[model samples]
Target chain A: MTILASLLKRDLGRFLPGTSSGGTMLPLLFFLAVAMLYPFAVGPNPTLLAATGGGVIWVAALLAAILPLDRLLASDVHEGFFDQWALRGISEEVVVAVRLLAHWLSFGPFIMLAALPASALVGIDGETLRIVELGLLAGTPGLAAIGIIIAAITVGLRSGGAALSGLLVIPLAVPLLIFGAGALSTGGDGGLALTAAISLLLVAIAPFAGGAAIRAAREG
Target chain B: MEPFRLAARDIACRRGDRLLFARLSLALEAGQALQVSGANGIGKSSLIRILAGLARPFDGTVERAGTIGLLDERPALDNDQPLGKALSFWTALDREAAPLEQLGIASLLDVPVRYLSTGQRKRAALARLIGQQADIWLLDEPLNGLDVDAVKLCEELVAQHCAGGGIAVIASHQRFDLPGMSTLSLAEYAL
Candidate 1:
């Protein structure tokens, strides 16, 4: 627990005003702006909007959420933060756990917010919006977990771009997108149920995937 | 706190296509320091990684004791990170000097480390060692950028760490003088 606390603290501690982007708040606002622009850009077609709203919102959330991941571990892995975590003699599994959670908190919320305004473009109604939002809230952590594992693998490489992450990450995340949209399409209760099952599955998969990813990245 | 004793036999590391060092055998005991002297391209840092447990060598077993503190020439700081928060990466360190007090870098602690001068960043890395409470010190050109006083402070710290049964292994091109430190020139052992 001490190690977990310390690792968690260290992972989240990067957010201390001085450590990372002091202007991080701006990104959230940027997402909001982007989402709002979608409705106008796509033309307000209600039927077209509702059918696709769920998928568009999820993709946009993922796109925005994934933007910073490569950079996230890029800095720390090179800085020996990952190495120190390795040498701390703590379980690397726990470090991965802490890091994924922190990344979700930092990057995932903005994705949700980014998708919120864009939801209108797809013709999502009020209740659907709530379901999608709630579904997103529950499901985005899985995206972060998957994204982080992918990022950790690529961070040490000289060329760790979105292209590279796509190669390894797509297969693992299909369920997240599928069930994520399922929850919103079917209703909150349905989405909630799927999110629960998927979240549990993610917990099982995260440790192994994250562990391998960290090791592979560091070896590079 | 014998600077963690290192027990290694037949250790060899291959950095890439080339073998950095092979069939290497050495035992570093408490209160001892060994300088891993070699040319720049010979995998000095790679050896440090193996010792620090960050990398596993192609062959050989190594047993290291105590917390190992590594100070590479680069300091491994995130330029975007401030001095104080960046310091957290050195989890092995426990604080001994306030960021501002030791290197006159207190004001810059909040500044992105990338924006700082190379010398300033180096100081922050060294200061992190003071915080780590590490008994096994692996310094890869720790003297890169520092005034005479800071070098002396480092020497004193290493000496103290050794005096407390700690150990230090350093790799450097510059001349570093210390009493009773054993020297193993990688040149002499090169294949």
Candidate 2:
């Protein structure tokens, strides 16, 4: 239990926004940039903006999640953190699990919080904003899981891994995107429940898959 | 601290399509030190990793009864963090304070790890290893990047560790002087 706490504390320090890792502000700024630019690109049509804004936010959130994926597990593996942890009898699964939580905490809630201002920029109504917020809350854990799994797979790549990881996440994230963004259109709790279920499934499997990837990377 | 043992039998290591070494075997009881010496690409570091259980052998078995501590090329410190904060992360996990003064990194605690010289970074890694206090030490090229004084200090530290009934396995082409240290040449086992 103490080990988990220390791991969480260290991961939070490395991953938290505004710290030396530069984690906090970049994704929020990027999400807002996407929101702020959509109106300019499409011209000022209130109905059009409101109708498409929720989808745009979903896309923006997915892209923002990608921004931190490259840094997620690559740095620690390169710096020998995983090797040290293995020597201490700490499983890679545990480390990756803690990292998944830290990765989500670093950006998931913040992105949800940023949605209010973003909704204003994109002209989403209060009702739509509520759905968007809930969808994101249920969906971001899946995003974080996708991010960590891809990060582990790509950590051993020599070059272009950051770009590759971003590419890999999009296809895997489509289910989350469909269910999450579909909630806004359908106005049903079923979509939200499915989104949450997908998030739960991804969250459950990420640590084991990611742990195996890291251990495999050690061989190479 | 308790009675410790590490032994490898009929080990074969293959990297990619190439076999680095084959049919290598060795054993160490408590208070013993072994130095693995060979030229570059001779599988010295590979041997150390195999013993540390971080890498799987192409064929064979490794048996051990003790915790393993490893020091390698990477210091494992967060480059952006101050030295003190970086080491403290491990200290907190290990539940032991690092011997910063003994490692001569006390004055360097405030510096970002990236700004430190190679030798300073090596010393910081040593402090982390000391804090771990494991029964077996697997050090890969521990003498690299150290000044003359630091090298001597490292040798002394290893000697002290062995004297305290801990085991040391060092893999380096560079000479590492320690009393009662046996040397293994990987060239003889190269396939």
Can you give the lDDT of residue B82 in candidate 2?
93
List residue ranges in candidate 1 displaced over 4 A.
Answer: A1-10, A13-34, A110-116, A120-122, A166-171, A184-192, B1-3, B76-78, B88-111
Task: Give the TM-score between model 2's chain B and the true chain B.
Answer: 0.98
Model 2 chain A: worst 10 consecutive residues (lDDT sum):
A15-24
Model 1 chain B is weakest, by summed lDDT over 10 consecutive residues, at B91-100
Report the C-alpha lDDT of model 1 over B132-161, residue by residue, as the tens digit.
667788898987877787777767767777
True contacts kept of each: 0.26, 0.82
Q: For residues A1-220, what per-residue lDDT tens digits would candidate 1 score against the true structure?
A: 6567666666675642234454255445545566566667878877767776777676667666655566556666666666765655655677677777777777666666656566654568887788777777877787777777787667656674667875666677677778777776666476676775776677667767777777776664
lDDT of 2 by residue, A99-124 (tens): 99999999999999999999999999
The lDDT per prediction is: 0.71, 0.94
| Span of 10 residues, lowest total lDDT, candidate 1 chain A | A15-24
Worst ten-residue run, lDDT, model 2 chain B? B1-10
